[model samples]
Target: MRMMHNFFRIGGVAADLPHGWIDKCLDFCDYFFTGVVEYQKLITRNPIFLEWVEGIGIVSGKEVLSFLFCDFIL
Candidate 1:
């Protein structure tokens, strides 16, 4: 959890994700760590959650592409 908070602090600066998004991320992380929320129900009710997952994939793809070219150059 401490590592997650630190990652959020650094990553949030680069990502500029909205407060609501950050709140949801924290809530999801809390539930994940605590096992308080049922995974199936959360997924069924919150469609935005899928969007968030997709967005992460997009960001990660961009990062990977950049790194591939960057390594070639360096």
Candidate 2:
């Protein structure tokens, strides 16, 4: 969190990540309490929204295999 404060002081982005999974990203856990509740609020019963997002960022089968070993920690 101190790193984020420092970046904010310099007018840079306080956070970034390498995934399409924003709701499950580490930065939210780093800052927000009840992150799961917040995530559910945005997508509750919203299948159309989810489908649109998946269409835009869908991973290819080969790419998924290549990235299967990448680690994501929360």
Candidate 3:
């Protein structure tokens, strides 16, 4: 109940939202977008990020198959 809030049901929500909550959510949405833009400017535009991530996840088909079929129990 603590995690699920007990206000959610199979069909829909079991309770109406509190007053002013919608405005708060809308404000957060705007703030979150600005934060995303700021983060992209700081991280995605950095040359080090490209150098760090380039050629990082290269995987062969044999490695993929071995990983998929490996037995982990020992």
Candidate 4:
């Protein structure tokens, strides 16, 4: 299985963390931010992705209210 079950209890975990678990977890925490930065650099800062989203689907407050108040059968 991809994950473990019966590892959580109502109040706490089923048992103490395994040896080296904390170190591994700390390493993952360190790596996670780097992964997020890499993702942002590759995706969010990409020129092609920005070009696709630029000036698209822009809505004004008036337009939003018009849609929100428009009457229709539910």
Clashing pairs in 4: none
**Each prediction's Cα lDDT score?**
0.68, 0.67, 0.83, 0.83
**Candidate 4 lDDT over residue span 1-74, tens digit each:** 74478877799887887899999999999989778978889787899999999899999887787788773422
TM-score of structure candidate 2: 0.31
Model 3, residue 6: C-alpha shift (Å): 4.8
Instruction: Tell me the RMSD of model 3 versus the true structure.
Output: 7.2
Off by over 4 Å in 3: 46-74
Q: After superposition, how far is residue 30 of candidate 1 from its true place, in Å?
A: 0.8
Going through the candidates in order, what is the number of backbone clashes in each?
0, 0, 0, 0
Q: Per-residue lDDT tens digits of candidate 1, residues 1-74?
A: 53544455643543566769978988899778775457676886777987667556355665777788985644
Candidate 1: RMSD to truth: 12.1
Candidate with better TM-score, 2 vs 4: 4
Which of 1 and 4 is ahead in lDDT? 4
TM-score winner between candidates 1 and 3: 3
Question: TM-score per candidate, in order?
Answer: 0.25, 0.31, 0.44, 0.40
lDDT, model 1: 0.68
Candidate 3 per-residue lDDT over residues 9-36, each given as its tens digit = 8898987889999999999999899789
Ranking by lDDT: 4, 3, 1, 2
lDDT at 61 for candidate 4?
80
* Selected candidate, larger lDDT, 1 vs 2: 1
